[model samples]
Target: PETVTAFQLQKQGSEGSSGERALGQQEGYRVDESGKVYLPFIGEVQAAGKTVMELRQEISMKLIAFFPDATVQVRFLNFRVTLIGEVARPNAYIIPNEQLNILEAIGMAGDFTPYARRNSVMVMRERNHQREFVRVNTQDTTLFKSPVFYLKPNDIVYVEPLKAKQYATQGDFLSRYSPIFFPLVTLATFVLGLSVR
Candidate 1:
């Protein structure tokens, strides 16, 4: 129960099954870049800036105005988010529902690696041709409340690794540091012991 409550902030995504979906846009029609989508009997519908659920209701209302016996559904087909950086897999994933959020987006990208800088991740969003950035820390419990937590179409997530990534030769770097740090600490302790004695 607690796990789900924690996950609920971003649980719109289900574990992806391997298969290709049949192509159709019956949920709700999308307005193009020109902001217009054709509904079955509702003519052209404008759907930009509205959530999937909102769009569905709007289309349903329009359909009902004419035919009370008609049933209609609306959803997004091309809506997607892109993830990059220290994740195990970097890719774009389509959102299956209007409820899809940032965690779902990350899950679609195959999750993060051990090296991922959980505190250094950033999200980029575009609205009205202008871009905005939101920083997120996966280590924090309140991350779900962040504006980036709720994704928009075409959002980009970037996960940076710790500065340790800069040390391409880790063994070499460790060897150099260990040799210096080990003796330095030991010598300091030894000197303190002698003075106390």
Candidate 2:
């Protein structure tokens, strides 16, 4: 879930005033599952497809009638991204600010794992009610200027594992069951040794 904070400011005097004071400390509005923000007098307003600036403008226009000098500053409270697959820590992170590059997000996940494929990193993003996938190469310098370089809210970074890692996992499965098969072979060898003696 995402939330927005609206900072309301009002001019001091009815006439032109150079000074302004905050109406309150801060007013937080939670974007519900339906993607709408509920205001005091405005009821529910759709906040999903709108940017922070747009939401601010909409809210300011709605409140202008009640508070003539009202001005609003809207900002998203949480910027979340998920790192999965071959990263050191496969988990979701809440970024402190809105601007976060792909490398920075990877660093927050403790970098990639030993088996991570640096050339084939995948970024899954959801924008404007649609999901999209992008491939980024960590080793390439061009990644810096890529459109997908900057991550957005609810973005997912997936680092693919190398072939060696997949083979090692298969080897592990056999190793886990080897003890059960090993004992039977050892018993047959012991019986053959006794018969030969």
- Which one wins on lDDT? 2
Instruction: Report the lDDT tens digits of candidate 2 across residue range 165-187.
Output: 98999999879988987898999
Question: Looking at model 2, how many pairs of residues clash?
Answer: 0
Error of 1 at 95 (Å): 2.0
| Model 2 CA deviation exceeding 4 Å by range | 1-27, 68-71, 127-130, 170-197
Q: Residue 185, candidate 1: how far off, in angstroms?
A: 32
Clashing pairs in 1: 27-73, 27-74, 27-75, 28-74, 28-75, 31-36
Model 1 per-residue lDDT at 131: 90
Root mean square deviation (Cα) for candidate 1: 12.9
RMSD of each: 12.9, 11.0
Per-prediction TM-score, please? Answer: 0.67, 0.66
